[model samples]
Target: MLCVTDRMKLIHTKGTQGIRGHTILFVVIGLLITETSTQAANSTDEELLNLKLRLNTWKNRYRVLCNKYSELAANSSAPVINCTGCPDGWFQVGDQCFLLTRDVRVDWQASKKKCAEIGSHLAILTSKEQHEALENERMRTRVAYTDFWIGLTDVENEGDWKWVDNSMLKTPFWNTLKSEPDNNQSGGEEGEDCAVVDSKSQSWYDVPCSFLYHRVCQMDAIPLQ
Candidate 1:
């Protein structure tokens, strides 16, 4: 039979092992809880990101629909061309109104006057975006392979170009390949001082202001109240 001291020792050892097992079990449970919390946080972050993307898409769609509605409303008023956004025949792009004419061909001066009569001016392309828009319009209308007048000229001073709005022409969009703005006279007393959109390249070229051609007009788009 075992002694009393031996029995006490055995009980103590078993008790220690039981305490160790419980400690290990508690550690594993804690680790599992931490892992679950981290996974839940990551899932929440992904969901939030998805929501933001969807919101942006919906906003863009709403803007397009609003513009379409505005266009339809403008068309409803037939006789009176009171365009609150863009006129019936005009295109609205980036807060501006553009009108491309194919039928009316006239000199640069006459074209400018006509645009003024319609409460607009010859188009002054200040950026590549405007230039691309004009190009697209030209293609859409399928204007003849001929020059079209724009609002740019070096009339005041030689080699010093300016727009009809008195804005100085900073970025030159002339066709370099053709060596444009050559100020060619083509057997005329007045050398080329006006700007024209070359039919071939859709780039600006200096031509005589007296030359007759179709013109593009632009004005600010009236915002809806």
Candidate 2:
């Protein structure tokens, strides 16, 4: 019933309306995506801020505790070295702190005395784990085939080894390869009375107490409250 030109105009109008509807739908979807991204970014910023605040709070608390400990230590006669953990330059293993000194080499007796002066004792390797820790530390120093004195000696009675702590040696972890503790008395030595740990093999060997070597020191870790 309509003329050709009118029919064409009606078709064009419908097409325009359809295109406008699609544009509106796309704009709505884009706005939703942008809003969601903004919200997520805001949430992430809040979480990061909270984490930073907590870290700062903990650091402040640690500083206060350190100051308190220092004051207490100054007043006490036998100053309790209650570290929050191991003191600086000391490594913590289990409940013990260990320090290996590579600079100063001294005889067994002198080494033991030095440790006492520092409120520690020559290292006592009571277990394989303790031995391993010392071994690992030695490796870290990159000192190859070096000997380090431990807190073991049979000076009181030959063949009756004991720890400096006065504990009788139970199960020995000696390196039998070179027939160690042979008491070889080589080079006119009296006897091999003191024990030294070999860096390479991580094994124990007895050398003359007068022999100079590096030393390892051990102390009890600070108790946690």
Candidate 3:
């Protein structure tokens, strides 16, 4: 069995193969180095404060990655470099794992929290492939819910959407026909700050964060040797 330190080292030495693979190295290195530097006695107050802020960012990344690692590992596949597939109950699309909830409806924030409770977060679709994969998955599953909460939201500043990872929204697939994400005031007092994918139309639309809906949770699929 590979130890945590050894696994970290192995990841560094081999490096992740793709764009997202390097994410672990970047976050882990920043987290470890910033943590060490923060302990230095000669650091200025401003420097310490900056380090703490960066550390917090890195820590968030670490938490997201760690959640994926734990979930994938929990599936009990024989330890190997190449991953066989996503764990039970999670379907794989590219290098990520996703879970579509059923018989459970909750508000956007509650859905996000529930995903975290299970070591995941609301789905963040960054690519057309991911979007199509999820659409097909929804069709195949035949769920009753048409709208499912995703990770995209403009809660921090309405109309300026971002994912759970704080990344700016790119390659969006909003339902243009509906003129969605208008932050429609009719939705609620705070307006529609959260996004949900319409399973039938295969498009996303902004909705009130307080509205109850099913959710699609996602996490990275990290394979360990």
lDDT of 1 by residue, 1-225 (tens): 989999999999999999999999999999999999999999999999999999778766766767677667777963333334677778777779988887667998999999999999998877777777777776776765557788898889989999999989888889998898898878287899899876456689888888888888899997544
Poorly placed runs, candidate 3 (over 4 Å): 1-84
Which is the winner by TM-score between candidate 1 and candidate 2? 2
* Per-residue alpha-carbon lDDT of candidate 2 for residues 1-82, written as tens digits (9 for 90 to 100): 8899999999999999999999999999999999999999999999999999997798678867866887787888755554
Which scores greater on lDDT, model 1 or model 2?
Answer: 2
Error of 3 at 162 (Å): 0.6
Tell me which residue pairs clash in candidate 2: none
TM-scores, each model vs. reference: 0.60, 0.61, 0.61
- Lowest summed-lDDT stretch of 10 residues in model 3? 78-87
Put down candidate 3 lDDT per residue, 21-117, tens digits, no spaces. Answer: 6787799999998887886644677788999999779766766665676777778783523343466778888678999898579999899899999
Judged by whole-model lDDT over C-alpha atoms, candidate 1 comes out at: 0.82
For model 1, how many clashes? 0
Clashing pairs in 1: none
Off by over 4 Å in 1: 1-84
lDDT of 2: 0.84
Query: Could you arrange the candidates by lDDT from highest to lowest?
Result: 2, 3, 1
**lDDT score, candidate 2, position 17:** 96
Clashes of 3: 0
